[model samples]
Target: METREHSATAGPDVAPPVLTRIPARMDRLPWSRFHWLVVVALGITWIFDGLEVTLKGAISGVLQEPGTLHFTSAEIGSITSFYLAGAVSGSLIFGYLTDRLGRSLFFFVTLAVYLCGAFLTAFSWNLWSFILFRFITGMGIGGEYAAINSAIDELVPARLRGRIDLIVNGSYWIGAAIGAASTVILLDPAIFPVDVGWRVGFGVGAVLSLFILFLRRHVPESPRWLVIHGRSDEAERIVSGIEGQIEKETGATLEEPEETLAIHPRKSFGFGVIIRGMFTLYPKRSLLGLSLMVSQAFLYNAIFFTYALILTRFYHVPAGKTGLYLLPFALGNFCGPLVLGRFFDTIGRRQMIAGTYTVSALLLALTGYLFTVDLLTPFSQTALWTVIFFFASAAASSAYLTVSEIFPMETRALAIAFFYSLGTGAGGVVAPWLFGTLIGTGSRMAVFYGYLAAVVLMLAAAVIEIRIGVKAERISLEKVAEPLSAKK
Candidate 1:
């Protein structure tokens, strides 16, 4: 084995390529406080995202009031679309940077961007400023998804990867639950003025985000990424530090790592390589990734983003009271992944993913039919969605898990960004616009049609999973897909 640094601006900078034990060292470690720190620091981004999104949904009705920004229904939907647009743009721009610049750098940069956008959103005076600020916030979150998912997958032992990834992704709903409850208090007429309440919602997200910044600074760079990017010495040092800490924490000597991979350390990898890898080298996995991403994005953004609007518009639920309903919905979503996550590792990815997706789709169809027939009260409607999303949430989280693990390590962040941007573009951005239009029509059948569309996409994703889902459970990422930089 050899370790050396290469300088930038030297043409085709290359170091002595050799076998490295970094990935094996990481994968063989026992559960330790270090893992918890990584989970909390990087995983908390989902919570902030959930908080940002739920706060927006919770305050959507407030924004429509005469005393507030007085946004129209279409304007409300447009705001979500703007957020998705910014996310798409950010994922592409920052995701490439994440792969190029390293995970640790982008996580801090992205969070700072989010905090700025979120704080500025509190001061929004008009619809334009609010939407613009939301877009900026979305950009921050979009980048977080790219960087954090790659880091988590790379660092976690393959045995625990599925459960941890699902649980971390599902933590979004814990923040959703918090945002929903907070909105109930903030939007209360006795507690705060209608105009004042909504600004406070955005302010709370920004404030909470600040605490996460301190924790993120402690999480180290991915050792896998480091070794592959011509920084083997740093990778070795970081991994060794983690092992020392883990042994101290557990008070046990660690076993030696048995597997090591030989990799060529390249200073630069081009987009052409990634593009060719996706389309030519691994085509089926690419399709599977897209299918999962698109379906879940459409379903979640279409419904969750507009829950308040639907309650206020059709169900006539009070704006302030919307959180009460969303509370239960959030609970169901959060619990799904926590409870069902282990199955992805134990029962296997294909069966569990397909089962969850199929069941959720069926429930959505049933709920849509009942909704169109005017048989559901606001309480019952929420209850049905709760049951539906319980499964859907786990399935949705799996989509992220799938993309992160199935691709070559060299292109992992970009692949996630590609699928997320593409999926969110096709499903996430468009669904909100379509649903907002449907809800504005004041026709139950129109909204039912929207539900049916979600059903079809989910069903397609389920079928795709059954046919081509990678049995990636309990398998190291390098085994899942050989690293692009692996020496022949």
Candidate 2:
């Protein structure tokens, strides 16, 4: 448990180098209640995001009713864009803070922000007010993406990081399913007034966030983040406590970790370091991260945000009944990661990421053609989407996984935030608005053309993966990409 701090060979003015085994100690521990606690507490971020999004999509039609806000399809799309804009800004602000401050601090802060935004959304009086509140809610969830992914990846054992991350990211659909199911009752005219029902739907997310905030109080700060920030003593204490707790729970002694890393511990890393790491130190990885993130974000956001609209506009499905179609779609999205996650750790990242992206793209293209030709019934179209997203979900989740684990520790959170913001900004913020406009045109061919664009991006990303994807499966994060401050 000893951490040695000594002057670097370079000079006295330089930050002292800390030689520590915190990462190995964490990676070698047996899976226990502690890991599950981390999963449930931090993993729920995706669920909340899924709920927020699905609720919005499911109620798009309801909001257009005269009893509600009377939003047009184009306005609904713009609202989704506003949410993405908030998320992009939040990720940048909180991501820098998470890297500089600590992961544990921001977890509570971001969730609290989301709670407030969701609660306020229930009381919005007009379209502008609703859009503003949704933006605020997006900020919280966006911050959660940067902080929670960094924290979870740092805390989990290296051997299990891949599957665990995929499962956790995939759990977004659990919230999607919940949102879809609840809207069925919440939006039903017989059960609640149209305006009141949509308001209650948003309130549900606030209540869920409150419970998750309580659970997060039990989760600890990441030892890896602590050690890199010149808090080696605190990191040692936390790791030892984790080891002791796990041993006590299992009633068995733990083995010593053989690996140790030497890093120059600094109080904070400047943006210059992040800029260099991304541009100078790891340009290829930067390209890879962006490609994966942008492709998936474009495909998912464009489709999911506009899904209910397509159902109502094209297939003439009832607004209240959209949730039933979404239930199966959500299930397919969830099951893809749960089922295919292990392969990323076994078959390896390059093959699986490339394979899934390519397969999903091909499927989507086929489905788009079917829709354009007017061959799909609403049930058949939903069935096709359920199948397509089965692969697309896994591909999308892997994008997050790749970005989080492929950067230096000093910049991990910010790197995640940067790529997430850039990709989401480029792909996510525009997709919903663009697709909404297309759907508003009332042309299946126009919508099919949009799907074709998404397919092109996915194919290009798959090619990039085949060319340069990291062999990160089952590898320690340190080995995946060495820390910027590491001393050879």
TM-score to true structure, per model = 0.93, 0.95
Per-candidate local distance difference test: 0.88, 0.89
Candidate 2 CA-lDDT value: 0.89
- Per-residue CA lDDT of model 1 for 1-488, tens digit only, reads 34433334334555555678788778888988889999998999899888887788778777888999999978987898899898888888888888888999997999999999999999999989988999999999999899999999988998899999999999999888888778768888899988988788888788878999988888999999988888888888888899999888888998877677877777777888777766778999999999998999899988976777789998899765777888899899999999999999999999999999999999999999999999999999999999999999999999999999998887899898999898889777688779978999999999999999999999999999999999999888999998878733
List clashing residue pairs in candidate 1.
Answer: none
Error of 1 at 353 (Å): 0.9
Task: Name the best candidate (by TM-score).
Answer: 2
Determine which window of 10 residues in candidate 2 has minimal summed lDDT. 6-15
Q: Which ten residues in a row have the lowest lDDT in candidate 1?
A: 1-10
Which residues of candidate 1, in runs, are more than 4 Å off? 1-12, 309-316, 439-446
TM-score of 1: 0.93
